[model samples]
Target chain A: MLTEILHTLPQVLLDGLTLGAVYAIVALGYTMVYGILELINFAHGEIFMTGAFIGTAIFLTMTGLGVMSAMPALLALILVLVVTSVLTGVLGMGIERVAYRPLRKAPKLITLITAIGVSFLLQDLVRFIAELKKGNYIITGPSLFTNQVTVEASSLFSTFNNAQLKSSSIILIVTAIIMMFALDFFINRTKWGMAMRAVAQDRETAALMSVNVNKVISLTFFVGSALGGATGVLFAVQYGTIDPYIGFILGLKAFTAAVLGGIGNIRGAMFGGVLLGLLEMFAAANLSILSGGVLGGEYKDVFAFAILILVLIFKPEGIFGKAVTEKV
Target chain B: MNLLEVRNISLAFGGVKALNDVSFTIRKGEIFSLIGPNGAGKTSMLNCISGLYRPTEGSISFEGADITGMKPFKRAGLGIARAFQNIELFSHLTVLDNLMLGRHTKMKTGVLAGGFYWGRAQKEEIEHRKAVERVIDFLEIEDIRNIPVGRLAYGLKKRVEVGRALAMEPKLLLLDEPMAGMNAEEKEDMARFILDIHEEMGSTVVLIEHDMGVVMDLSDSVAVLDFGKLIGKGTPQEVQENPDVIKAYLGEEQFI
Candidate 1:
């Protein structure tokens, strides 16, 4: 049993990392929006799903025209990322303007209900469009990065087996890292970022600082949604299939990641995302063996939520939880 | 000409009147203090001037232009800056960053430019940092520039609050109870600092202070309010001698 665990450890970590990268990126949207507004944007997952659909559609069109495959994969990847990010960013801002902004002064519970409503609205809207176009809502997009690579861990250690992943996994990780670092720099060092921190702390006082509160709120939506949207594109490409409903479950998990790391802490969310991903993957590989077949891989999600419940019970502040109410 | 002209401003929430037909003028580069007992509408009048409360009846003109309906942020842009009665500093941020936030309106870097954070953005940031540093130097808070405000002593936090307003380089400064919770020594220090900010910065100051000693010593002009009504307005000495001001403070009773 020990040998079996060792043999699969490397493979699990590799696969887990790829999935974790997506979670960390998507969790950012939840954290960023929650930092300022304190409202869990339920539509965020839908935004990610929309990005996946849009990314796939654009990828299909580019390939259909015989251009996407002809371009370098990196350039092609960037093009999709930028286009989808802007579209989803705008959608997020529009969501805030039409749905969240009007209800901002209303009760928080009302805003939350409205968010769930928007989430359902987006799911149905995307479903209708996808079904009209392809006759099915679930899509299998053409792989832009299909090359596979295997890490030869067995050569270095006798018990460890080799781990394999497609070339898209590398792209996903590098992109996620770059995006994460960029966001970190923006929040910490930039003028607008400072203003964001101020507004998050005290909205009325921030206005007294001459920080345009409305514009700052709008920009927050744009950046957070843009990150989620781009992650959706990364998700569809790596997984090779997507549907409008993918966001609901994935978003809940990503939200779990956000809460596990302190909800408003940016760096905490990133660490939480990667940690959750690795844990989930590990559970999937070892749960049956560890439980003596009492549980199967199907219990991975339950394991994740159990951890959330435990954290909420024991350390409700979070894993790295300080007084994170105002920290950027 | 007066720097700020409040023309018959009245603010009412439903049936409760916070301010009623309150009018006053603040001259440029002078310290104008508003004094009254509690609920005298002194703070309400300040809120109206700062554009936090839109007076239901009248208009406010700053620098000779009407700003009655402008937003609070817009008023800040027009050189109106205020420190709250409570220390409203961003508690999580360092004192330097809190002061830097005062330069928010002066900054022009957009999201993309900010995200890049090099070249022009770096230069723009440093320039603003220099301005904030000057404020730090003047406030003598150089030692605590990097300290988080939430951890600071109460007196120091109050100074940082005023320093934040000073960083804006405002043409008109509004201070609401800047020395509300200070000890005698701290109050004396704040009073000196307030005078220095007025004299050296050349900024018009509108002060709301409960300390009569500080108000009498600091204000070039004084306005007394009772129940949202401006009962008297004159120099500190004249206001102190007025029958209306005496009645408002002494409650129409004989005093030794």
Candidate 2:
């Protein structure tokens, strides 16, 4: 077992990176929404699920039209990502308008409950739509590039045949990194981004500076949810199968990732996602050996939640979060 | 023509009148000051003009346009800027970003342009950064240009607040106790900046102040409020000589 572990460490790390990239992207949605309005957008997971369904629909439609192979599959993938992101962005804004905005001044707990209720509504809504269209609840995303060998590179770190890198993992990591870079630049450099940070810091003062507070808030939802949509497409591409229920546990983990990174901090979300992914993967792959077979891969999901509970207990602020002393 | 016209503006909360029948006109290129003791409605009057509060009665006009119903952000877009008494800076952001936000209306780049961050968006950003740089120079906040506003000293924080207002290039600048908690030397520095802003920037100034010396020296016209009533309005010397103004400041026992 030890010899097998030594041979597979690099592969496991790569797997973690791919999974971590998805969580990081989804975590951005949670963190950005929380940063602006200080509300845990529980329905965000459903928004992400909606993106996956949109991707599945687009892929199937393209396949039927013979456009799946007419152009490079990458272009179709990009189209799916962009279209789903935009649609999900609008959906996110609509959710905010309907469920969150009226409760903006209400107590925090009410908004939290509303967020959970929204999560259920979106899940059921997607299930209902799928049932109507396909006559079943489970949907498979159209296969693209899963069999193609885009790259065949020998493993340099380990002298093992099992360590050969896959093209799918490469694409996933590269695409996720590009999106992360774009998001970071947009938040830090743009004027509207600055307005977001300002509103996050103090809404009333940002409005006084002529920031159009509602517009900033609406844009926050747009950008965050759009990212969530993109994340859904990526998840579908990597995993090959998605259902309406996929976002539930994944969304919970993404939320955990956001809180793990530092809930309201942008960079923190990304860090938290990647770290959570690595931790889960590492624990699942190696924990049985490390613990003398006391814990196995079945306990993988348990590790992420345990980390979350530990973080909440030991350092509620998370890794990249600063402890703020609220002024009276 | 009056730069700001507050006509019969009355604000009340239940039975308590915060401002009552207060009418005043601030002419262009003049320094106007509002002075009164605690709970005397000086801050409330500023709030009414800045659209933070909707008055119970009367209308407010800016440049002859009735703006009594305008939203706070829209009012700001019309070149009216304000510095808060309690220093309402975006504490987590750097001084440069806070001041750049002061020019929020001047920046026209939307989210798409902002995301691209090239071509016209880059050019517009450079232009606005130049404007903010000029404000940074004018306020002499160069030493702490990149520091977060939350970490700055109180006097410096207040200066950044004023700088933020000036970044708007406002035609009408409302300063609410800009030097309320400053030391003697800081007050002197602030008073100089206010005078320079009035003369060089040519902004119409309305300030609420508790410092009598700074108020009397800097103001071209003074308005005194006592129990929500406008008891006096005139030149500094004229207000000084007014019996009602003296009574409001010194108390009835001193007059007796």
Candidate 3:
């Protein structure tokens, strides 16, 4: 039994890494926007789902037009990425302008409810559009990775199946890393980045120093939304499916990741995502041994939430987050 | 000619006029002070000048350009900078980081280059760091350079805030209640820093202060306000002798 478990370890680890990469990408959007605005942005998940659908639609249209060749397909994917990212970025800004901006000085609960409303609105709009296009709610995404690639390893480690690890996961991780590095550079090196940090640290003081407060807030939404879009496209590509409601659970998970890493901490979000992903995978693989029941396979979410609760109770600032104490 | 001009500026919240047709001008290299009893609109006037609040009427011109409705960042770009009444340093960031933020408007590196920490970005960052270090050393906060501003004591935090504004290297600097909530020693230290900033930097300084002693000693010229209106404007002794200014302070039993 021990040997069997060891055999499954490498595969489980691979699974965790791929899953964690996705969570980390999505969690970044949550953390960055929260860092600047202190808003939860509940509609971020829907924005991600929209990106996936947009990419799938582009791919499908290209295939239908007999342009399934690799070059054209890749070009089409790039187009989808640009289009989806721009669209979602604009949508995020729109949400801020239309829904959140007016309610900024309002109660936090009101802002939260407005976010929920925006989420529902986006979900339903996607569902309506899908129905109008295909008379079906489910949208099947293109499978970019169907060929199996096996890498042989020493007996000390379990054999790995590269095919099971989607190329989309690799792409997602690389893109997320690039984007984060870019964000860091923008925040630390550029004039705008300095303005953003200044605003985040102290809005009134930033204004007093002649930093444009509104522009910084709008830029925050744009960057956060663009990240959400990129994560969405990656999710659809990895899963080989897209649905109008895909963002629901994933959004909550990403939010949990943000909170776990320290909601307003950027690097913390990335770390939290990977940790949450690994924990979920481990719980799914091992929890079944004790219960010998259904809790092992599909009950990973329950375990994830349980971990989230425990983290909140024990270390609320998260692994890398600093606790804030205001001077009254 | 004045380098910065405020013309007939008035600001009201609801029905209460915070500032009413208030106007002033500061020449280059001058240390100007705005003094008043509590609620005399000294800070409000500074806010209007810094572009934090749009005047209900009238306009502000800096360097011969009309900047009445320009955004705050644009104003900062035009070489206007300020330190707040409350110490508003970025608590999570180091004192160096806070000062670097002040130098933000001067940075010319592109986002792509900066993100990758490439050649120009690296050079620019190093240059900014050196500049920030100069400010830090000038302020004598080198011991706490890497420590987060939040961890600093009140006096140190206030010093850091001043350091941040000085980093901007503004043509005109607005300081709101720079010595508020400070002990006598801290106030003396701050007063010395302000004098050094004026003499060494040669930047125009417009300050609001409740400490009459500091104002009397430091100001080249003083503007006095009472209930949103200008009651007096002159040298410290001239304003001190004005009956309206005296009545504005003495009539209120709270002025003890």
Best of the candidates, DockQ: 1
| Model 2 C-alpha lDDT per residue in residues A189-294, reported as the tens digit of each score | 8999999999998887787898888888999999989999988888888888888899999999999999999999999999999999988888888889888899
TM, every model: 0.97, 0.96, 0.88
| Model 3 misplaced stretches (Cα beyond 4 Å) | A1-5, A65-83, A151-154, A157-168, A181-185, A188-190, A294-296, A326-328, B7-10, B14-17, B56-59, B63-69, B108-134, B181-189, B247-256
Proportion of native contacts found in each model? 0.91, 0.78, 0.54
- Candidate 3: docking tier: medium
lDDT of 3 by residue, B1-256 (tens): 6998889999999999999998888788889999999998988898888777999999999988999998788888888888989777888777877888888777776545654677887888899889889899999999999898879999899999889899989888888998889999999999999999999988889989999999999999999999999989989999999999988988845645
Identify the runs in model 1 with alpha carbons over 4 angstroms from their true place: A323-328, B254-256
User: Across residues B1-256, which tens digit of lDDT does each residue of candidate 1 receive?
Assistant: 7899988988898999988898888889899999999999988888888777888998889989999889999999989999989889999999999999999888887778878988888899899999999999998999999999999999999999999999999999999999998999999999999999999999999899999999999999999999999999999999999999888887876569
Error of 2 at A321 (Å): 0.8
- Runs with alpha carbons beyond 4 Å of true place in candidate 2: A1-4, A148-161, B254-256
Comparison by TM-score, 2 against 3, better one:
2
1 or 3, which is superior by TM-score?
A: 1
